[model samples]
Target: MRENREIAHTFDTLADLLEIEGANPFRVRAYRNAARVVDSISQNVAMMVREGRDLSQYPGIGKDLAGKIRTVSETGTLPLLEEVEKRVPRALSELTQIEGLGPRRVKALHESLQVNSLEDLEKAVDQGRVRELPGFGARTEELVRNGLKRLRGTQGRTLIADAEETAVHLERFLSGLQGVKQVTVAGSYRRRRETVGDLDVLVTCRPGVPVGKWFTSFESVETILSQGETRSSVRLRSGLQVDLRVVPEISYGAALHYFTGSKAHNIAIRKLGMARGLRINEYGVFSGDQRIAGRTEAEVFAAVDLPFIEPELREDRGEVDAARNGRLPELIRIEDIRGDLHAHTNATDGRSGLESMVDAARERGYEYLAITDHSQAVTVAKGLDVERLRKQLQAIDRLQEQYDDIRILKGSEVDILEDGRLDLPDEILRELDITVCSVHSRFNLPEAQQTERILRAMDNPHFRILGHPSGRLLNKRDPYPMDLERIITGAVERGRFLEVNAQPDRLDLTDTACQLAKEKGAKLAISTDAHSDSGLAGIRFGIGQARRGWLEKQDVINTRPLPELLKLLRNT
Candidate 1:
């Protein structure tokens, strides 16, 4: 958002996509390498340029890229980007959304077949035209065809939380084994991309035994792609692919450092390690003579004289440096989440009853899960009216007694009507455990109007949090314009928690804005905004974005334990 590497990587990635579409391998690598550099820098690239600092001073920022970064900074738009957008369907990047289709193939199809969209790509494959391409014979074409078929009508990318679910599942499986020392997720999944491309994992085990044997034993084993003493790749029944590597315990730290990649970050660390005469790889760090790490991820990092880095911050963007300087922001953990402040039940579109949603939360290790089904204003959603609200309150009382450990918070995701007032009556609002005011319609409002609409709702003391503050749907719709800074500032001043809607389509108070909220000393509530029990899984996605912002448990409102959460919510 600020023209830093995280921001630059988008453009650089776009550059690579164009290069791939342009079919220039070397240029693609250059743009990718530069993007990685932008991602790895600890300082703001855009800010540095404004100060007249040599943009190329950063390791990955070359003279050419320095120019590109400046253009983007000055205009908030890149001309090259516009040109590429015209030549390629910006959604062609969505082809990257399809597993097994790299930019080259995407470009190839775009170039060779005029396959502009998934629809066109599917048609080409079905017609057998895709089989005619170079290196793409019958089998590869069938693979592409199957991929499209499998994903047909799927409206959104797999949420980052979904990937984390798989990661946790694998972590549990591997951790349960006899010889395993530790397991962790690595790659972009660990970085918490809104939509993960695939899952990459790193595990540490005692050496002198084959870890591949353990890989063959997982519940969803489809086929082993390749296996060596240290690394293996495989597919699962769900069509997700995973790569696993075994490292000695001592190398665990460095192996994690390497595998939990912002590849740019890994390269930087490896380069730093190289200067000290250490070579690092997935297995571990190698000294001039010996294989030192036999166990533990910490020992590997200690070998290089740095503290261990968290998986989330491993994005080569200053993490190693942050590790070196001890400047890393302590990230929020799932354990820190006290409750989900926004959820629904059968009263609306939710698949289960309120108690069942609470049960799902309890089973997933939450202290409480707020049930905020639609307020009466959302007639399409069958939102609760005064009478139904009373019944829900009774139901909450019954459940609170029955499930002693889990607190059932009465709440509603009340629609913020076009007139900028919450739909629920004041009497009803006063009875709720939590009140989340949101914009479900009129997303076309202008920036000033949108900001004003939300502020009007925030003026209500009952507006405890604002849901999906931006009203965005990834790959589907961009959020309506709003003065985010104004909303966060107002929310903080009013002692209201800003909601980070975890539903993938809406990672609303996205990392950038969430970080801004923290900078402004605002509290955040990370809610699943879940519609089903499994929907609670979106909580991890919110948490991932929170971590990316370098959020601490203290920075989040829900990190309050159940008692603390209750007092905060009820204004007690």
Candidate 2:
């Protein structure tokens, strides 16, 4: 069965390749739109195919696209993609992966420098050839070089979302096995880490059941590295490694606890057990040859006189003490969020238009949605100029009149220039309901300079949230040099806020940073920075980061109702 993400990726790559080939703009857009639809649909594409439903019924998907989707679902391959691959080298498609290199920039590079591969592009940059390009300057060249280095550093691991999708499919398949009783995906997947190295799946089955054999039957399994009666390991076509183990029902919970661990957390638990003359392992807990607790995670915790800890908090970060003292934070949940403050529209780089974005926010049950499109500094996004922003604000004012259920606020994700000035004028910024200032350029500034630059931006009374404060992309770029602690402290003193950007690629304000914000009594907003309505789903990743940071509902600014949230925003 084809995963939704895999099919979506195929479509996205096809669209990018077509764009590089200078295909029709409408044709390229059709594939891109279809990719978004496939990626964001609530249900699995495999399930839809299995049920024989019409995939063309979905937005942007036509009969031809539907047939291609069916082919991918049934055959695990798309013929069009195969045909396209023959003409376009895989390296050319990959060139577009670098940050700031859109299809147009990529096309420019290929045409000007004959750089079809990462190595070729890197050599060109080393020779000082990229900086001389028409659109790409010294800054863009440096950014691309850094992006390539980061990509190489984190090549094999998959995003947590991708791993979870695989786990969901595999778990469903195993649950359907005749003799299997329970299927639990342990390891980092269960803990909701931002990136997962591998998956460890624990299954409980009736005696004499051959569950391990059934596991290898998964269609996505690319190669069986090892197989045994009780255990098996395989690599999926997506390059994710998966291991399956069959545990006795009595030890299922213990196995889950043992495998779903940060080694440090597990060591702490083992030490705590040792102090009490209790032996703990993947088997049942033991006290002087007597089995005590192992059937449930709560039971395992209770055996050591500790409270059950959420998987997200299983990182030995004072969680042990918190659990022991019954002081574990009640982490924020997805339902606690009341609105999204930083979102975009087709007026900028966002794929969807204003009305469509608002409708998507409505679907999420948001009490408020802010149109925080990029400001004038970010030309690549066609960031809004003064006149365009005024028109957008007026349009937002009009849209607000039509919907009494949700408040639509006019906002801009304005840029924080290198000189510590905001991209949009304070006069225009104050007119909006809120202003989200971010650093779009000069990410390589020194620590002291960067800190001062942001502090000066925060000096503006209109500036509310600091968007993706560190400017780091997970597995793609290290955060720019800045004293984050001082910055967080400054935010508190100035009544400014930090954002936990929800985009998977940019889960900035890491878990530790979120906790720091909470400790300083500065609120944080978990925004999708969504470029499309479908991008709203990225909020889950943000919530995961928040929970891991031990954030509670009150710690997040958006958790409050509209009126209260508005008051908070105003005061801050």
Candidate 3:
């Protein structure tokens, strides 16, 4: 069965190819928009198709696009995509996957120098021919080369969001099996890493149950790599490999601990067990072949005289020592979030209207929701000008009167210009409840200049938080050159905050960066940067990232109640 992401990828590829072929602008945008709508939706599109439901009712998916979605879900390939691939080399679409190479640039390269693939692009770069093209300079060529390197480095890893979708589906399926008693997805996935290389599933079942065989026969299984009574591995249609293992009920805890690990953390735990004249392995902790403890993770930890550590903290980054001293952090949870600080509506590129967004926030039991639409710098998103933004503020006031349950704060995702000035003037910024200043373009500035640029932006009294601070799109664009330590320190000095953007593709302020911010006594706001109501749920991903970085509820500003949060914003 095709996943929503697979279907979305199909439409995106078709759109990219159409654009490279200079097809109608509307035609290309329709497919691109359809892809966004499909990917962002939480529903199982393939199931919807099987049930004969209408996909056309979804946003950006009209009757024609709905038919294409059904065809791809049923047959695993889009006919239109095949037709387009024949006319334009499919490799060109892949070229667009490289950063700094949009459809227009790819077309220009193809038409001028016949650069059809990565290999051709490499050759052109090597011969210094690419820089001689109309818009390609030495700097642009260097960026392309670096982007290619980054792309290859992250080639096979799946984003955590995509991996979670697959893992959840499988876990639900396996839990329903008659004899299965426990199922857990281990490894970096359990750790909530930003990217997952593969999945490790541990299960406990009855002796006669054929769990491995059932796993290999899952509907989404693309290839059965190996199959057996106790263990099996299969490749899903999304190209993610999964390994399932069956362990005894007595050793389920030990197996889960062993599989869900960083190698260093496991080694440290094993050494601790050894000090007590015991041997530790997946089976259990044994003292001369007689099992001591293993029935639960807590039992295993107690054997070593340490409290059970959270999976996100099992990275051996002082966690073992912290556990020994009882200093483990009380990590932040999704429920601790009082409200979302950054969100957009139809006023910008967001899908829902203001009233609908307010209703969604109220349904979630939030005290406040900031309407931070894009400013004028991002013209592609139809960013608002001064007059338009003032109009939005007036509208927020009117909408606020209708809802006492949720306070709708006025805000804007203002653009931080390349030269350290803001896109919108200070007078207008002061009238708003909040400002999430961000760097939307010129991501290639040198380290000193970029650092200075943001530092200067932080000097503004109205600049509340640094949005997507690193400006990286995972597995696609690299973070621009900047001194993160200095930036964090600057934020601390200026009483500003850093945004842990919860968007799946741009979970900026990485786990390590989050840790660094905490070390520097800087605060963070885990906002969804949501473009639609469904996008609001992305806060879970940010929470996972925060836990991995050892953040607690007190360390996050938005976790505070509305009055305290407003005071903090005002102080800034």
Candidate 4:
């Protein structure tokens, strides 16, 4: 590690600890100084450790700082992490993710105003107390309000979807650089969280021209927070910050694994590394007194006696055991899905006509796609009545004829009204290709009532697919209170498919629920419920959630071919 990178990391870690313990500046600076020592060392820290050098021997790392380094090296975590967690509300870090808030303001608010949680902050703004604080005014308060509003309705915390595109763009750009051998987008974004705070990119480039030439070429840079030989930080045009670090090609994979983290997952792996007499960090892998492997992720894991983990499974959710035991679920793959069984058209609230949607589905090589427009009750979605639905079915028949390879299954996304009944009449439901059922309204029911309502709706002979069973939008909204286990079990017994909605905003029957449903013998369906032709791409999100939940091809009902799906539909 270069001295500068080490210093930067120390500052980064200090930032967390400072925020956690409300530590005053100087104490935090000690840790920052130690981080600088590690980051800036031209000689490997592993080599230093091998020489039996005590970190205490290094300046800036006093007895206390040395202890932290020892803990970090041995545990892959700070021993004080839990203590820090206790001192500060874990959510203070989250509050920082809101636009326009930083550590200084967060500390000021916490100390002076007792605003620690997002809810508390929201309340403070609503009560007009925040605008009264030093360095804050009505404009800042408005930004805070908008920040809360933007963050409030998310399904989970992650880099924005648009940020992902930016990351891909950066990856391609850096990879194309003359001196670059490899580049990767890492951090929380790689883990697919619903929102992100910043971007981390690792670059491995050939040794030749200095980093300055490469760094200067980025004209989109808003501000260069820092620039050095091995690492740099810059604010981008989109108001997002990007930090790039250059490493040797040999360490690219290990560096990526080290940086791409959920923190918890990395800590667990580090523990594993320690138990095996190995040290793991962004610098790569080391056995006591020896450099082992740092060339690839496979090599790093092999050094630790584990299989390489996929990015999606890096959520610290029992992946280690799954890898150790070789029972990682065969996870649903994109190709296994042969058709989309729920959709809508301009005949309802959808933007495209039936013909265009079916044509798009055919273009994707789907053998069958359902045109399940909204039923009459969902007026906001322009839901249709039986008479209009009859005309929509005729259009489906014509589209099916127009494209022989694509079969448009007549269907309707019937609303499960407040009283536990389908909005469409039984005759209309029976007339459709498939009757997909869901409760889009009445989310305020008690858990028991919600469970009963859904069970009763699933019992309808016409009901085939249960969409987004919990009606959650990840971080944005809480799931409608319901007894999930009972709902899944009853659906299993009744032989109805639980939908794994692919919409990014609503990957409901979340991976956890889908896993449970599969465990309970309930079948699962991956439906895009695409209201527009472009929205059809949402299946990709569903597949990601399914993979996270350990779903396999056989666990998903929609993975079946057209004939098999038709057989199941007819049986329903």
What TM-score, computed on C-alpha atoms, does each candidate reach? 0.64, 0.90, 0.98, 0.72
lDDT of each: 0.75, 0.88, 0.92, 0.75
lDDT of 3 by residue, 1-572 (tens): 67889999999989999999999999999999988888888788898999999998877788999999899889989888999988888888888978878999999998898988888988988898888988889988987888788878998799999999999989999999999999999999999999999999999998899999889989999899999999899999888999999999899888888999988898999999999998988898999989998878888888999999999999889999999999999999999999999999988899888888888888889999999999999999999999999999999999898988889989999999999999999889999999999999998889999999999999988999999999999999989999999999999999999999988888889999999999899999999998888888889999999999999999999999999999999998
Best by lDDT: 3
Clashes of 1: 10
Per-candidate clashes come to 10, 0, 0, 22
Off by over 4 Å in 3: none
Q: Per-residue CA lDDT of candidate 4, range 308-364, in tens?
A: 887777878888888999977776788888889888887876666777778778877
Runs in model 1 deviating more than 4 A are: 1-117, 120-158, 165-184, 203-231, 235-237, 246-252, 271-283, 286-295, 316-322, 358-369, 397-407, 474-476, 532-538, 561-567, 570-572
Cα lDDT of candidate 2 equals 0.88
Give Cα distance to truth, residue 349, candidate 4, Å. 1.8
Give me the candidate number with maximum TM-score: 3
What TM-score quantifies how close candidate 1 is to the native fold? 0.64
Q: Distance (Å) between predicted and true CA of 134, model 4?
A: 35
Our tally of clashes for model 2 stands at 0
